[model samples]
Target chain A: MTLVGLAARNVLRNKFRAALTVAGVAVAIITFLLLRTVLWAWTAAADYAAKDRVVTRHKVTFIMTLPLSYAQSVRSLPQVKASTFCNWFGGKDPKHDKEFFGSLACDTETGFTVYDDMVVPPDVLDQWKHDAQGAIVGDVIAKKMNWKVGDRVTLQTGIYPKEGDWEFRISGIYQAKSKAVDRSTFIFHWKYLNDNLPANRKDQIGWIVSRVHDPSQAAGVGVAIDKVFDEKEIQTLSQDERAFNASFLASISAVLTAINIISVVILVIMALVLGNTIAMGVRERTNEYGVLKALGFSNKHVVMFIVVEAIVIGVAGGLLGLAIGYPFIEGGLGRFLEENMGSFFPYFKIDPRMSVLAMFLAVALAAAASVIPAISAARLKTVDALKRIA
Target chain B: MDTATEKAPASHRDKAEALVSLRGIVKIYERGGEQLKILDGLDLEIAKGSYEALMGPSGSGKSTLLNLIAGLDRPTAGSIDIGGKRIDQLNESQLARWRADTIGFIFQSYNLMPVLTAVENVELPLLLTKVPSSERRQRAQTALRVVGLEDRMDHFPRQLSGGQEQRVAIARAIVNDPALIVADEPTGDLDRKSADDILGILEQLNRELGKTIVMVTHDPAAAERAKVIRRLDKGQLK
Candidate 1:
């Protein structure tokens, strides 16, 4: 038999211990994969955010509203191709109050033009425009709430208390064409909400989204738009959509950093487990190494044997981790999170690079961890080593 | 006294056609701030194709002598020339290569790798050489056959009795056809029948194959089978 084959056989010398070590490494890899996926899914919105679109919001906070006249000024910019304004409606379906989804009152005419990723039939858009009370829900939310085009639904909002519940008919359902577009939003005309609102809250918009003619000039166009309202009663902060999404991420950067650190910590823990096992194996086989040296094997051969054994264990554990992780994360948890937490994780599938990295780290770290023990074993004095029984 | 001298003793051929020779060998070990001399200024010569036994009481340095002659260790002072090469002057890496090419070792505990089968254990030494795979396997099988263990080639060490394990260890020792074989208490752990069986194999390996054998044993009965028996007391041969 070849030396490598002989070395690999040593891994099975203690079958139960080897199995447990493999399982420990697999568990660590699974944990690492899950943490990495969480970080990837959290920042997915920013990663896929439209490059050519700019968002204008209140300078202080998103909770404050800008005057509706700001939308006309933003649309008139030389770089602006189209613009739309929307306010967070904070509406909840009375039938399913436990479920969460985005609800916005947007300019129906320009909303479909600026956010072209939301694909609706031309007839449905026409129908929604004619009927002021018509509301279009995303396909994901429509399936969840069991609403159809002709069905009428009622919503309740604590922010805008009216004499009675707000009523609307489902005019259409829109499908998302891009990963950045959430598939669970419910949109209705902003004029209907303004018409019913008191005079103090009327004629106000939450934010404006503008699409630029040239994506390279979108940032410059945003600065020019914000300049127009710098001296107005309420100033605006403008940024490209990616930067706007990144601002939201900046608020929770600490949490993301923690996940990243924990992922590396799991790898370190795997190395420790592997190192301990290799050390113990080398200790028990100390006499065997002496025997090998006595039989004309060199110190390098002894070291190679130990390292090859560790690599075999690493390969077994890495394969097992991927076997369990792919189905658990990509198939089950990913679908659930995408449907339930669409705003934060629109696309929750594992990145191919994450899987490759996890496997590579498992093998590399296992090999690296064995270096100390292997060297120690190889460095033992042959005469002294043979004196001991172990 | 020159540790770096690679010259062989000039009177070696005049000393009974010696294949192994030692001149003024001294080995000292320090323990707890005390100097313990395991072997004093000792000199020895073993002829080619001779079966010799080294018998000594406990702490008499018989095993230490065996280690020096086998090239597993160097003398603290003086020279050890085996097969006309000054092994004491060789560095660790060169000694390892020399050991693979010249000396074969059989230990008391039958130190065969448990993970390998009998034939694979026998093939271990040849792995260090340029021997091709097919020839290595053929030579290992031949060695096992020479030791009358052809039927047990596929068995692991755990499956074999103490006698059979010692036989496999013997096969491994002789598989490389080394010029010198050094065995230390080779049958110490076996029963009377197994010990006799191992002794028979050693005698056959020496008389039939013309192999030079140097054995260290406490048993007088085992030493009687050798062509020459030397006793050691206080690190000096008598």
Candidate 2:
């Protein structure tokens, strides 16, 4: 038999312990992949942001608003291709109070043009443009609320206090063409919201969104637009779409840091589990190593036996983890998140590189874990090792 | 003075040339800051094709001397020449190679790899050599046949009796066709019947195949089978 074959057979000598160790490594691998996927999905929005779009909001906070005239001024810039503005509605359906989704009041004429990733049927778009109180709902929200075209939906808002609930007709159900777009948003006409607002709030807008002619010049265009309002009564913070998403992510940087630390901790736990198994195996086989040495095998050969055994366990555990992890993440949890939490994780599938990395880490950590045991086994005196009972 | 040029006694020269020669052998081990000398300065010689047995009480250094001759351990101060090669001067790796090519070992416990079959255990030593896989298997089968355990070649150690396991270990020792066979209490763990069977095999190997055998044993019955019996007490030959 080959030396590697001998090492592999030794791993199966204590079947129950080896199986338990493999299971431990597999569980660690699954936890690692799950945390990594969460981190990846959280940052996917910034990674997939549209380069040509820039957002202009209040310098101090997103809660404050800019004047409606600021939209026209942004559109008048030489570099701006199209401009639109939206205000957060904070609308809730009384029927599904616990269900959370995004609601926005947007400019009807320029909203679809600036946010081009949202696809609506031409007939529905026409209806939404013509009707004063018409709204376009995303397909995910439409399915959840069971709303059809021409359905009358009433929403209660915490931001704007009206005499009664606001009413609108569902003119369109939109679908997202990119992962950057939330698939569960409700968009209505900003004019409908502005006309009903009190005199002081009538001319206010939440944020202005503009598309640039050249994506590479988006930063320069943002600077020029902010210059327009630099000395005005209200200063604006302008950024490209990616930078806007990054700033939003920075608000919860602690959560991201925790996920990162937890992912590394899982890898450390995997190494420990592998190391314990290898050390135990080496201890039990001390006499066998002596026998090998007496049979003209060197210390290097003893080290090989222990290291190869650890690596075999590592490979087996890695394969088992991937087998369970892929379906669990992509098929089960991913579908649930995309349906329920699409605002945060629009696309929640596992990345292929993550799978490769998990396998690589498993094997690498297994080898690293075996180092001390392998060296100890190699340094043992042949006569002393032969005297061991096992 | 170089021990290689030292003249041998007339009686040893009258027999076949010496296969193993030791001069001024001393082994010391330091434990907990105290030096314990196991084998004091000693000298011995074993001729080729001779069957010799080493006998002593506990802590008499018989095993230590056997280990020194087998190249399994080094002497703190001594010269060991086995099969015309100065083994005491060899490094750990070179000694391992030398042991593989020149000496076969049979332990008291029948230290067969529990994971490997009898034939595989026999073939293990050949892995370190340049022998082809097919030839290695053929040679292992031949060695098992020589020990009259050819039928049990595919059985694992746990499946075999103690006597049969010892036979398998013997097969492993002879599979490489080394010049010297060093056995440490080969029959220590066997019953009287099984021990007799193992001793008979060793006798046949020496008489029929002309293989030199050096064994360490406590049983007087086991020692009587050898052509020459040497006794050691407190690190000195008696």
Candidate 3:
């Protein structure tokens, strides 16, 4: 008998239409969340990147490398506290030919030091540094490949095309401490790649990474590093880690932007679905509205009732979407994205804000959807409504 | 003879002093650039708790006049005073507020919200008032009990018979305890048995509860039950 109870009951007047409207809203919210998740994960790398770390890449192309001696000049900068380099190994496991993971050649000792967020066990780091032909893999990658700590694995180099299969002993496994770090990379000593390289590729580093003494001076250090090699035959583009991650993200900018737009479109569609359902219900209940008016209900009261009904339906749909979306994403999509695109998305979970916003949007859109119908229903002439056959 | 010609509820005459007075009320409807006059300077008055029937042919403006008295429609040009206050001058929102406080309405078709149970439908009018929901439900139940529908209070409209539905509608009308009750063809869609039952309920409400009943109906049997019957032709009472 309460207004809220009556409003809630009114949503079930046409069970099928109401159910369809709720389903439409649920689908919209789910799609919106999915797309928003994509957009969030795509930019997460840049957002979580370290401001104190600087990256040095070729000014013309990332494919080109800088002289290993460039590390000396980078370390000499007053702002640079620690400096190292990591060359993209571009190595693939011969057994699992299609599974994509990062392979990097890094300074055995200083590489992990500069990027200390990546955690490796003490024994593993010591063992990795001791062996020349040794590599450390991520725990996730090791579990997938089922490689033991001491297993000898051979990987084929796609870029270099080694004369024979490049073999390495699995010296250790590392784990990521944050979402920003990829959990499927294989990092080996730079000396291992450099010692076996041809003369043309010898003593060259893919990109120099530096940790700054102060985050405020990071931009200055980056400028100084680029300036040091700006006039040389090989120029450098030095930036903080965030900008370095952004360049790679720029490759899939179109997909990310499209997803953003589609997320908005789903919300718009949800609004439309809500509006249509409310309009239809109001039209069907015109006579009932007229009866209410005759019984002394103010126009405001009538409108409130209609809007409350719409909002009740909206809440139902929002709760339904939340109930379904969480399990669908975490159980189904999360595992798929984590296993397949670990580099881009370490975890595919819905943001708390997205769920909160969905609830807000549901209520807001429901009220908005009822605006026209409520107004028109409230405007019904009492006599005219009475005269209605129904 | 009384100054108002004694057209008042017989039992409540002292309190029934011409609650609704309409002088020269006219209503014109414009449809697609064509103007149609529904009411033409109709003048009438009814005292409180009067059980009066308005009988007329189609397009006779009986419903229009009732709508004006109930503050549900505006007069094209006239003065309408209900309960000693001029109501025709009120805006739509003001009229709505006034109607909620003073008027109860019943229709030929039981225009109950089908989604609501009979008690919920009865409780609807109290939403316009300041009554709390629990009190509203109690009042609605009392109203349904008065109409002998207490047992059916929890049933939806579809589950009730035509007469029961009409009784539920009447319960809803009186739930607000409004001074005036306006019924437009209250039993127009009912069968003989249902119509008789509805008519009996209205009679009881008028005689026992002293509710003001102003009904517009073409049914002679329904008109006969009214204490006073007014005939309308060409938008004028005759």
Best model number under lDDT: 2
Model 2 chain B poorest ten-residue lDDT run: B1-10
Docking class of 2: medium
TM-score of each: 0.94, 0.95, 0.95
Query: By the lDDT metric, which is better: model 2 or model 3?
Result: 2
Can you write out model 2's per-residue Cα lDDT over A1-390, one digit (the tens) per residue? 899999989889999998998888888888889889988888888888999999999988999999999999999998999999999999988888877888999999999999988999888899899999899998888888898999998998899989888999999999998878888899999999999998988989999999999999999988999999999999999999999988989998999999999999999988987998899889988998988988899989998889899899888899999999988988899877877887888778787899999999998999899989999988998899999987
lDDT of 3 at A182: 76
Error of 2 at A166 (Å): 2.6
lDDT of 2 at A247: 92
Best by DockQ: 2
Q: Mind giving the per-residue lDDT tens digits that candidate 2 earns over B1-238?
A: 1222223354754768889999999999899999989889999888898888889998999899999999999999989999899999998899888888988999999999998999999999999999999999999999999999989989999999999999999999999998999999999999999999999999999989989999999999999898788888888887
After the best TM-score superposition of candidate 3, give how far the Cα of residue A145 lies from its true spot, in angstroms.
2.2
Q: How many steric overlaps does candidate 1 have? A: 0
- Rank candidates, lDDT, best first: 2, 1, 3
Candidates ranked by TM-score, best first?
3, 2, 1
Distance (Å) between predicted and true CA of A22, model 3?
A: 1.3
